[model samples]
Target: NKGIGGFMMIKNFKASEKIGDIVARFPKAAEVFKIYNIDFCCGGDRPLSQAIEEQKLNQKEILERLEEQYGTLRSMELEDVDFRKLSMTELIDHILNTHHVFVKTELPRISDLITKILRVHSVEHGQTLSQVHKLFGSLRMEMEQHLIKEEEILFPKIKEYEQNPSDQLLAEIISVMEETENEHDGAGDLIKSLRTVTNDFNAPSNSCASFVLTYKRLEEFESDLFQHIHLENNILFPRIKA
Candidate 1:
């Protein structure tokens, strides 16, 4: 991972500007933002220019935003500050508000929808729906476990460290975090598969409200996970490491 200093600067203020709004707007930068544990999907309300500035990045130092649409580029910067020095607690709050709420609310609904869809569409779309069902179950179960580990095992330890930086506690948290990260990857990949199985969540022409809501919630849920993982893997873990 690049030291926070080596992180890429935003290119094309307009293209990258959808930092906190819709994920579809800045698909390319999604990867970049993912690296920083920044949310450019569900919580993508800030402009790219603003996000760059907020991070206290070197504005003049950023290369052009790399997009297929060549030559459409812009530059940005903010008042000098360092993101590496920010509080992990603040970032954790963002994760809890955005991602945790998403999982807590959306996961059960998606699970129910998949169960319903399988009964309705499985005869025709059995293959895809079955895969979707499996993934949905896997994600739901895994995430529940992941949440317990974070809330019960990890977050408390992190707090303990914040109160008193003990090498022993840090090592333990790091070990658990490593496992949590692997689960994050699995969950992320499963979400992508869910998208594919659902045909980008475009319900059939004769689809019911439940079907539509299922896809819609899945997309939103995926967006939530990206932000959640980004914060933990990129921001939270690093700060604790430091």
Candidate 2:
């Protein structure tokens, strides 16, 4: 994060630009918006100007913070390539290779951690940990099947559409993307439920290392899942046959 005076000059933001578009472009803004309880996910269609006014927020401060946070990225020599600019084929490949692989790898590891923590700490944190484990199990199962569906059905059709674009194929892409987005929402809802139950990733004072580690890993998993969904929902899906 940079100082307000060190913030970048953002001339591209339009008055009518929605909050989701802002987060999709400047992800750091998501944190600032979250501070104000602004929804940049499901109910993110409202314009920034309107949201600020309605919530009695300081528009200038929000803009300054967003620019400051985004400025840090500008200040750094980052190797991160923007997935949105890639060709449809390239983007789909990157999603499968990057985000999908990460979810698969991290999900199982965290699942194991949660299970162990629940068993060991069952006497102390059993109720909450148990709920977290069950919710996470459901989420993991959903994601496992979700990735398979994308790999076997969605990505192949997207690739086929890339080779031969047509109105019918475009409709199919839209339909599949819609279904995929819904599943993403379901997974997101489950994570939110877990977060609520866990007091936003705070570990109990008497928590063991495993307990702390499980909460930390769960938070990391939630962050990755959000970024994954944002990439597909905000960027890739919109480019289909555009």
Candidate 3:
């Protein structure tokens, strides 16, 4: 009876469920998916069943693991301050403090490290570091402009709309925010290219310290950018529109 009950619990996880929903709802599942090298960020709209099948993993094992990790995921998301519940101002401040600050600190440090890697490891890696440097430099420049646009124009308008609630303002917000989404997509595409050029951020064997650190920082950047986009595109924007 105990085993049967457990099987029933696992059965509740349908293959049709969206991967992002699973991760957002079950924070522990995010780590589990990470172990499987599953992308729960950009490609998160794919079905759970499809994702597991693509990885050729045992569904039962995944379900069992997810069932175990289910506890406290909701609480963790709460502690992270679910964007849906936050006021417009709080959301802006949170984005600036958390995601924006992370990029501002990490990007330049990582850029320098990758430059060092290019100097040291370019021979063995066949210009891989150079490619990464170019892509990352482009991404950083785009993101800086994007962030400034948000801080100077779109975000302030959204905050103002929160207070005033005018149709004219809302229309303008939608127009500018859509442009922001385009920038997000551009940044995302660059990250995807960077990942491809770097072969999914795997440093070569016998890689130096700079090589390893650069790859690590690039992976962290990708992860953070995805979360940043999710907050704006999925949670906050829709809430404002609603």
Candidate 4:
């Protein structure tokens, strides 16, 4: 049974389950799905095994990592908490201060780098440069709107519920959060596409230092996003779940 859960991890999602359903039940799968450019939200109704095979990924390696990371995923204690039990205002403040700040600061830098690289190499990598631009624009717009929606609508309602917990308010906030999560899925898709268009951000063998630095920065940005999303999706939202 060692491989049952690992293999089954990819196997079950193929049985008419949508991407969001799989991701909702197995959040860790997001990390894997992101790696493969699978649309686990909007275009989520596909076989996991087929997706993997079509991408030519090594299933053994994926299964091994899945087993290592989430072999006992079912028994994991992921519980909802009363946001009232904690400081909702402070949590919102933290998300804005840290994550929003990161987004604002890093996005322009990535955009500048994309423009720079395209200026230098677009003639040689025209299609990739075009994709990079498209991905960057999509991500920037999506994330900006997402943060606005969360801060203006969802977070405020969540805070209100903290002070005055009500079923009606909680229901509305949950609905909003679920929508935000789907947007997160799309943002995740943009990042995956960006990496692909950048050739995994591999600078040419003869690339200058600026090219190397840009790739490093992009890599760091993606890593930070993974952590940022994890905290929001796994910790913050769960705390507010009724």
Give the TM-scores of the predictions, in the order they appear.
0.63, 0.66, 0.66, 0.61
lDDT of every predicted structure (CA atoms)? 0.65, 0.76, 0.76, 0.68
The residue-by-residue lDDT of candidate 2 on 119-200, one tens digit each, is 8889978899889989999999999989878887888999999899888988887888888989999999999999999999
lDDT of 3 by residue, 1-242 (tens): 12221111213245577888676434446778888888899979999888888889888887777755542221233354556878988777667655665566567777898888888776887577778889999998999899878878998899999888999999999989999999999999999999999889998888877787678778877977988898899988887678
Q: What 10-residue stretch in candidate 3 is worst by lDDT? A: 1-10
Question: What does the lDDT read for residue 151 in candidate 1?
Answer: 69
Candidate 4 similarity to native, TM-score: 0.61
CA deviation > 4 Å runs, candidate 4: 1-86
- Candidate 2 local Cα displacement, residue 30, angstroms: 35
Q: What is the C-alpha RMSD of each candidate to the true structure, in Å?
A: 13.1, 16.3, 15.7, 17.2
lDDT of 4 by residue, 128-198 (tens): 77787778888988988997798789988988987899889989999999999999889888888878877
- Candidate with more favorable, higher TM-score: 3 or 4: 3
Which candidate, 1 or 2, would have the higher TM-score against the true structure?
A: 2
Error of 2 at 158 (Å): 0.8
lDDT of 1 by residue, 56-138 (tens): 76434332332322122111112243334656654554454335644765677679988998899877878888888998999
| lDDT value, candidate 4, whole model | 0.68
TM-score: model 1 vs. ground truth: 0.63
TM-score of 3: 0.66
Q: Judged by lDDT against the true structure, how good is candidate 2?
A: 0.76
